[model samples]
Target: MRRKRAAGEPQWFFRRLVAIGVIGFAAWRLMMLESAPDTRVNETIAWGWILLMATVVLGYLGFASAQDIVAIFATRSGTPYAALDDPTDPPERPSEPPRNFAG
Candidate 1:
């Protein structure tokens, strides 16, 4: 039995499917070019694949960096609750004064 997908699972699955399709198409095209007589065509295809992969990697990195920046700013804009002391839990004070070290 197939389990039900979560809220965003469908979108995730669709993205994976599209990625797989693109990679498969590229691989197929490359394989088809293998029998071509011209070496330039093969090199071009190889270079295109390399560029495409690089672009994808760079794009992912850029997205992650942007997310990090947003998260940092979000945290900075929020009030720091840790610094605030709770009224219910009052701080303890020393009852006696400190004695001289010489004594």
Candidate 2:
């Protein structure tokens, strides 16, 4: 028999499903280039950019959606917990100055 998993742990099944869907969509977008119509250089360049931007937008949206779904699953699986670290403590500072300093 399988052991019960704790809440807030990543659900592998859902994560895998989302991963497959994202990869499949990305592959489909790549395959679309093979069927692009014959056209002038300028138009072809524009079409290429359009396809590229579409893929980027699709990827961003897919990632955001998947994250939201995972968050939902995690929250629903169990009660939320308090932070383990002491909140009153100040955040640690880096040992050296940042590279962008112009002073």
Candidate 3:
């Protein structure tokens, strides 16, 4: 038997983890600055952080959706429904032998 490799072994996994960490840190910094009475937060920096985070999230989602759509179409030559009702194919049967049931 062959071993099946994990999907997105390390690249995508690490990228997502790093993105989440950066987003969390940015949010925490923003909140801390807001709560401090004397600290004046830079508006441009905060907005830039938010915009960058949104772009990363949206890009990841779009790429993932495109991969899924392409996989579905690439795997099949015709509609799934048509495959089930094709007349030339033999009906599938179980490989197990019949059991004696008289007890």
Candidate 4:
């Protein structure tokens, strides 16, 4: 009953898994640093780590949103994969003459 996945599906899933693991690890490290009184982690280093993790998370979100925007525009305009069908051939032009709007 399940549908077949595309060629890159497994790799995509693996990448997502790795990303989640990294983010989770970062969160766990932050929590540990905050809770442990014995550990002498520098405040500046902690702030830097927080900034780095925030950048990674924000960059991922931004990239995903940008991809979604592109997909939406592609669907609205025309088939996004039209070029993939036949890369060598140029796109077909409409037979009708161009319309004027100067009037």
Candidate 5:
């Protein structure tokens, strides 16, 4: 019998590389800053602002992820009716049938 590669190897490797790249880049930047001849306080302040922005972005992503989880739970847990599920307006007419007739 032939052996097959693990299905998740590529995805797992990519995730690991991304994680390492992020850490290594951050470390390299920090090290370069430490050796800089001139350090502007504004540059440090910019880094702080960037960190704050990153936090806000991460928070937004967290909220969206939570919303998705809630939607899944609502579907499984009950009738799945809520203000969020309410449509703001009628849906538009379909551009075409959802299924293809020529298939």
Candidate 6:
């Protein structure tokens, strides 16, 4: 019934951000040092970049981002898969009592 924050989202995503940032910075540095012809578009560079991106995706499979997607049915009236354990409570909302309670 409530929106949930995925587990380890911050830490996992930050790690990915740092990894990408480091790689991107290194690429920029290499670009600055290596001069290229303004006219010639290098197929090798394009192919290598595609291969690098695919490798990154494959690596992410091993370092999968965690999300608490399980659902638990305590009464056992639901599907077996639904019995999987996960957090039951929603994150507490910021406290600010309603200014008006008009019924």
Per-model TM-score, in order, reads: 0.44, 0.34, 0.48, 0.47, 0.34, 0.32
lDDT for every model? 0.61, 0.62, 0.65, 0.64, 0.57, 0.53
lDDT of 3: 0.65
Off by over 4 Å in 2: 1-39, 77-103
For candidate 4, give the lDDT of residue 21: 78
Please identify model 3 stretches exceeding 4 Å from their true place. Answer: 1-12, 32-41, 77-103
Estimate the overall C-alpha local distance difference test score of candidate 4.
Answer: 0.64
lDDT by residue for model 4 over 36-83, one digit each (tens)?
A: 564445566567668877877787678766765686585673443233
Please provide the root mean square deviation of candidate 4 (C-alpha atoms, Å). 13.5
Model 1: weakest 10-residue lDDT segment is 77-86
lDDT per residue, candidate 2, 38-97, as tens digits? Answer: 568646765665676567668766976776577667666333332234578788987896
Worst 10 residues of 5 by lDDT: 3-12
Q: Please tell me which model should have the higher TM-score, number 4 or number 6.
A: 4
Model 5, 24-81: lDDT tens per residue?
Answer: 6665666666666655774785486557556655765576566657865856743333
Residue-level lDDT of model 6, residues 3-66, one tens digit each, is: 3544322245665886687567556654754576543355456456557656676665545522
Q: Return whichever of 3 and 5 wins on lDDT.
A: 3
| Candidate 3 residue 19 C-alpha distance from true site, Å | 2.6
Q: Kindly list the per-residue Cα lDDT of model 1 for residues 25-102, writing each as its tens digit.
A: 777777877787778767888779767755755665576566656655766734322244449967888699877798
Ranking by lDDT: 3, 4, 2, 1, 5, 6
Clash number by candidate, in order: 0, 0, 0, 0, 0, 0
Screening candidate 3 with a backbone cut-off below 3 angstroms (N, C-alpha, C), the clashing residue pairs are none
Which residue ranges in model 6 land beyond 4 Å of their true spot?
Answer: 1-10, 19-41, 65-103
lDDT of 2: 0.62
TM-score of candidate 6 versus the correct structure, residues matched by position:
0.32
- Where model 4 places Cα greater than 4 Å from the true spot, the runs are 1-12, 35-41, 77-103
